[model samples]
Target: MAADTTPPALQDFLTWRLHRLAKLTDRQSSDAYTQVFALGVGEARCLAAIGQFAPLSVKDLAAQANLDKAQASRAAQMLVDRELVLKSASETDARGVVLTLTRSGRPLWKRVMRLIEQRNADIFGCLTKAEQRQLEAVFDRLIAHADARPQGSSPATP
Candidate 1:
């Protein structure tokens, strides 16, 4: 049989679909964070990273949150201004400061964790446990492939 020549629809593209889902989820989570905790998405990312892994430096938090250093620093400072995080001089590294959730931030972090769990359930609860595991494995492989690409090589460009 002759090959079909029809172009794939935009919605049928995996990359486009993945990006659509990401944007939708990000918007939903961002709205909830802003309404409930007065945190923007960037700030929420930083806060969540620090809350999950205390004593992290701005550099480490940036890496964990997949944000640039400047954005991470700004988010960290915002959290500091709100008293949600305590930035203290690192005992091991005098040049660096460690970030940890404040007494008030702990409860907020718990709330954020609950929100995240609920969001995951809402998005993926339809998938069976086996299907979820398969999806996770595919995601891991995609992440590894993306990570292995050379910097500045745009996936969208030839």
Candidate 2:
């Protein structure tokens, strides 16, 4: 009967490392968005989602932007208030509302897309083309595996 001497290190955790990377890139993107577009990260994401996939409902935008419904709704409202996006009645669902970029927002959306391209290049520039392709494949597989798992289910013990 003895207490365990070994302890887990934060650096050894894959999730923590991934989160750190995500935070770093997200911070950089957030700063860029705020400085260039005067937008919060959520607002920028909502705008991008609406621009890329017009006629989206709040729920659809949330999924597209990887945001919660509440966050998406709030961002959509802000975009609507700023006249960057138009909110209209959904054609399929009478009670549901659809979101689309406004005429003024088109140019902004193009700029945003360019900024995204630049940011991607800046972030992944260190990796070789082969490495980038491998990384993308690995990420796709991991995402697919995670998506296939049932919610709230714990991983099996190694």
State each model's CA lDDT, in order: 0.91, 0.94
Extract clashing residue pairs from model 2: none
Query: How would you encode candidate 1's per-residue C-alpha lDDT over 38-61 as one tens digit per residue?
Result: 899899888889999888999999
lDDT, model 2, position 50 = 92
* Predicted candidate 2 versus true structure: per-residue lDDT over 28-65, tens digit per residue: 99999999999988999999989999889999999999
Range of the 10 consecutive residues with the lowest summed lDDT in candidate 2: 105-114
- RMSD to the hidden true structure, all candidates: 3.0, 1.9
Per-candidate count of clashing residue pairs (backbone under 3 Å): 0, 0
TM-score for each model: 0.83, 0.92
Predicted model with the maximum TM-score: 2
With candidate 2 superimposed using the best TM-score fit, by how many Å does residue 149's alpha carbon deviate from the native?
A: 1.7
TM-score of candidate 1 versus the correct structure, residues matched by position = 0.83
